[model samples]
Target: MTLTTLKQRSLLGLKDLSKDEIVSLLDRAAHWEAQPVKVNPVLQGKFVANMFFENSTRTRFSFEVAEKRLGTEVLNFSAAVSSVQKGESIYDTVRTLESMGIDAGVIRLKPIGVLADLATRIKVPLINAGDGNNEHPTQALLDIYTMRKQFGELKGLTVAIIGDILHSRVARSNLWALQKLGVNVRFCAPPNMVATELDAAYISIEEALKADVIMMLRVQLERHENGMIKSAEEYREQYGLTVERAKRIAPHAIIMHPAPINRNVEIDDELVEHPQSRIFPQMENGVPVRMAVIERALG
Candidate 1:
């Protein structure tokens, strides 16, 4: 590979990544996934910190596992139990960690523009776990990895992302990267849940089932102000992937969710692990997809 092909220091979002760059990461993930051993010490002496200013279970744990698998020393920082709850700024918490000489940082924050700003200031490479509604690059990466594994190629595949698009960083990151790999992307959501800034097509949930991949996005109720969605039951009625809806999905198609799923809200509980579903597999694929990403940052 050329020098240009071998370089990606940080992953704040996928919006800025080229198709080849994304494929390189995916290809490397395939390499890591095939390894028989549990841990590799390629980054033995490296120190990586996972700093979360927002709440997470899957993303945080996934990154920690990926870091450990690479044999890197990890420092985990959660804002809930940290000084940030004692009136410290987000920058201060990150800067404090940097002062302690961490080699890299995996960050998830609540505000949109803060990560980009932090990227410019932080000397060590900074990987974004999730940055508000802006993007969750790694989640998108693993999602794409799962898709690639299932179908073997991404070009010309149709993907429909359903639920709270207005607050979904997963949708944006997936849209940008998937399109680069030649996937046709669409959004299906309530009017209030739609993001006006994105230029993608909007389709009814019924129409979405015809897609090659139907990705159920988590309804970020906490980010919804003024009771945008009337109720969980109501949202499920209009948009949820009910057991009835799953029957409509093309037999060859796959179901997905960035999960911490609202269960029967955006997707039915029965369908979460259905025969065509890739939900749990998505989480399994995250480790190697992330191992490729973390290795890229520290390599």
Candidate 2:
């Protein structure tokens, strides 16, 4: 790769990426999805590390699948089982992996700004799997990919992200990326959960239902005791997408969630697999979307 190409290797957040760069990536993801064979082997012998400092199911496994499908050698790291359990710093863990000669890394950490700091210090390309509440670029990419697949072009679509916004990296990434793609984005959350820093609209649940897409954020059930919410039942009653509320959305509109869903808490169980729900399709789309990202990093 040329020095200019090398400069584009690391993907820390969508905030810095322009509309064309993102659309090109989404196009690459579509190209990956169209291939006949599952394993392309384009990245044979390349090495990629999955360094997740936080607990994850979809993002971690999705990256693993994407890496192996491209024939990259994979190294999986978790704070729970790694030297970080013994108080080793995050930089030490990544630097240790760097010294071992990884070609690229996909990192998910809790501390804000840490990923950007690591990117400056680390030589290999680093992809942000999820960096605090700042961004989850690939997740947002898959989401936009899913929307484009359903609605053709993304322009003029209104997406109402309904749930906790303040701590949702998914919400932030989706908001920024979708807006850049000409989609109108808004939030519908309890007052405490709203992100005042974002430059988006805050709508009532009724107004939210009128949008082209209804995307719900996973409620952190543990926060019920935090006084922000009283209890699970109360939250479902006020904010959750109950079966009754699901019926109110336009027949043409679709429902979406970045899952590990709280089934009955954030959305009704039956609604999870509803015809209008793209929850699992988002998961299915994650692999190819990540393949595009991982391939970008190592190819």
Candidate 3:
């Protein structure tokens, strides 16, 4: 199908996307990466709204950049500043944005199925930045883009994802995206750190070590009770990736991390500097990958 078919489309998860759609996005991204392309000014007269209910650094800025680069104006709406804090229901808030003729909306929400509910009534395309621990489709797309660039290909590769799987949208998105792209994925966490729903035979960190890539996620201590980590040292002992662990992987295997790493919590400092580490590149690629998503969503 043509990229135009994706027009006014909402990207909420990778599971619903076909391989062709995924490749089309990557192909388009390749063109953007190789050249400086301007957003067709046709959209200059249009508007895109960002409705972020939570605090963010990358997702929020990336959407703004993508929309502006596409020649569209963006209006940022945060809960702290919006009427939602004053008891405005999501139904009323979305209707308000719609009344102003929003061309499209990108939402980072909390309640599960909130987007589904909003989509039923909203007239514009809606992209889900994140919804609780559900999914972060854009983040997953960027992640795959980073991995493809780093390893040159994703198929036939083994990838290990270590850390708090239960609370990580990054991990959930990565698992689905990588698996769909034909990469083997494994998880490693202290028993309780991982989600109960994460059960797969190939899901062991040890088995995935035979992999060509290792992606690490940071622990979400803020989401836990008891205020602080009971013992940071104990948490690391069973799950932290040390220099010695790095030596056991394939020579071609790469290391990755979704940013804001916990240093000694989920990974060793020495492993961060290894030649095989692709964490920095992953972080850097966030801009262009996001640019690609915006271009496709609003192009």
Candidate 4:
């Protein structure tokens, strides 16, 4: 499909996308990836703002790289040093930035549904980098792109997303995108960490390992105030992808993690660098996927 036919104006969540739109976007990403340098001047001379309210490593940097590679000038906004610390509202901050002539804004905030609200109030296209326990659309896009690169197809594939389902934007985005693309998604987490509201089937960790792909989610410690997990070791013993449990996984099954991984807690140290692990490749794929997203939004 041509870029002219792309339908999305802002990427709030994968839930707002159709299967075809997702596929087309991924195909565009593949086109970007196939090029030798992956540089596109589609967004040349435009200014994009990186407005992050929450701490991030992968999502923040990758979006910056994507913007630069696409030839767009980037304006970095730090909530820590900005007037946001002085109780400045999101609308005020965004509007102030928009008044300075930014073409689009990529935001990562800690509050859920804030992106949707901001999308309505902002004139520039808004890309949701992440929102609290809500959705991470670009992360899911790169994840699915990485899976497609590994397996060549997503049809009939079983993707078991294990751990911290109650507070994962990545898992929520993955479910919407993967399910729409004909993949069977299962959620496995301890009783306390599971979000019972989602319609996915619940399965044990052992059962999850048997799937075509296994995605380990990081346990969000910041959100756990009263200690839902007894200890890291106990959590690992039960649900972590330890060396012993990794051996039990199907030979063809691949492992994935949206990182800032908890090392030995969510996955064994050895298993993280294992041959079957797609952790780093997923990080690499983020650039092109985000390049596609930024280009589509502001190209």
Candidate 5:
């Protein structure tokens, strides 16, 4: 129940965490966010690595910033420039880093289950930034933090996650985290994009609009094969959060999207900055949440 209890825990996914542990991390994040600007130096003597096998904007930069802010020395690992490009195995790569005396690692890879496997081999704690379509624990943590900041509690809130469910690590992590906190969750997506293993209610987009939180997922075009979506315009008509559709959402409902938004594709550009949208704040919350994660992993 304390930071000491979280020491050396590898955050592979939200499914591996208890509701109390999740809430404790969020509470620590809030504490960090509320502190005055000063050098806390909580992680000054530690060294952490950011090993990203996939391209990222928010997760990559946020973790780096969080590490720097906490006074931890950061090693940025680029798979493109490393032996991974030459067909080196993940075990070898992680072992190589661990040999360098890295205290902990934040990994984002493109293959599902790789993080879990690598965590077993590495001596240092491995925090999953993302692993294929498997899970993104920190993103879900920041998301819940953002929602809790808005509603002051997570219990009894209904969350409808829309769009590319099959390829969304964010969706997977959020489902586990939210369900544990007593949130009602619904999934709305094109039939092909829905992961049947999720065990959530399949609802119409209109039905989803009625939830307390409407999370729009970015359509992962890179992961989709041909014919997954007929066309962007058609996908928008059926699933995109258009201006008209946005109007019908509950007045108190909050809109959320994990970024690199395709503008008019997943969500209307105008609606992104709307008062009810928590997208930006979600990004802002990433830093403090990650700070808590790194500190806990290495503290």
Candidate 6:
């Protein structure tokens, strides 16, 4: 079922999707990619409002392009031009947009549970592009798509999500999606930023690294305020994936990243350019997966 007419119309987090649901979306996304051009205006004449509260280049642009590719109109909303400057609540803003007859609202905000809360107020579909450090469902979908293309299958593969886990929405979503698909999941980050409170079913990094794919995340300065990271230098010294670190993986273990890399911070530049790196393709898949998501959400 397209997500809209399905009982659940909000894409707020990965926990809401089952493994089969994700695979079905991914398989459909792959089919859409093979077409090379948009053929159907499934969402024709509909309006999708891109409501972004945080700084975004890739996520926002990708969704805008994806919506237009399917023949839907897009209304771009930047926090700068909106009533947000007047201290208006998100509820009021979304209500105003819905009153204007928007078909769907895709948001990227900086507060966890904000989309879920807002979902209760709006009748149109809602897609959480990114919400605080909570979740990025589309990013996880694209990452899984890239993995399927690179490794041939997600099941039975060992995957390690390393670095900055505490503030990473991508990491959270991937853990849910990958583990659900039966991929061996491991998480490794400096102790403070590492994942905790998750199911005890999966192996921790020190143990899981014995065999699994390794995905590196960029460590930025903003995470310092989270109290999970003290300094970037310490982060690199302890958790950075250097060439020497790459040798610890089984010879065939794949490397992936959701880019805007830190070069030498979380992953060395050489490793990022390694033969197994799927970062670029991961970015490319964002287009079609998002197109699929938008279509299913608004169709």
Highest TM-score: which candidate?
2
Displacement of residue 4 (Cα, Å) in model 3 is: 12
Q: Candidate 6 on 147-246: residue-level lDDT in tens?
A: 8887787789877778778788888898888888988777776667656776424344455446556788778778788766777777776777777777
lDDT of the structure predicted as candidate 5: 0.89
Q: What is the TM-score of each candidate against the true structure?
A: 0.96, 0.98, 0.87, 0.96, 0.96, 0.90
Expressed as tens digits, the lDDT of each residue in 142-258 for candidate 4 is 999999999998999999999999989999999999999999999999999889888799999989989999999998665446788888888899999999999988888899999
Query: What is the descending lDDT order?
Result: 2, 1, 4, 5, 6, 3
Using TM-score as the yardstick, the better of models 3 and 4 is 4
Consecutive 10-residue window with the lowest summed lDDT within model 3: 1-10
On residues 78-121, what C-alpha lDDT tens digit does candidate 3 reach at each position?
88887899999877887799789887788898888887778766
C-alpha lDDT of residue 122 in model 5: 72
Error of 1 at 15 (Å): 0.7
C-alpha-based local distance difference test score of model 4 = 0.90
Clashes of each: 0, 0, 0, 0, 0, 2
Q: What TM-score number comes out for model 2?
A: 0.98
Taking the tens digit of each residue's C-alpha lDDT, what string does model 1 give over 130-246? Answer: 998899999999999999999997899999999889888999999999989999999998988889899799999889999999999888665445788777888889989999989
Choose 2 or 3, whichever is better by lDDT: 2
Record all residue pairs in model 2 with backbone atoms less than 3 Å apart, i.e. clashing.
none
Model 6 gets an lDDT of 0.80
Query: What does the lDDT read for residue 91 in candidate 6?
Result: 80
Model 6, 38: alpha-carbon shift in Å? 4.9
Question: What residue pairs clash in candidate 4, if any at all?
Answer: none
Query: So what's the TM-score on candidate 6?
Result: 0.90
lDDT of each: 0.91, 0.92, 0.74, 0.90, 0.89, 0.80
Candidate 4: which stretches are off by over 4 Å? 1-7, 222-225
RMSD of 4: 2.6
> Model 4 TM-score?
0.96
Q: Tell me the RMSD of model 1 versus the true structure.
A: 2.5
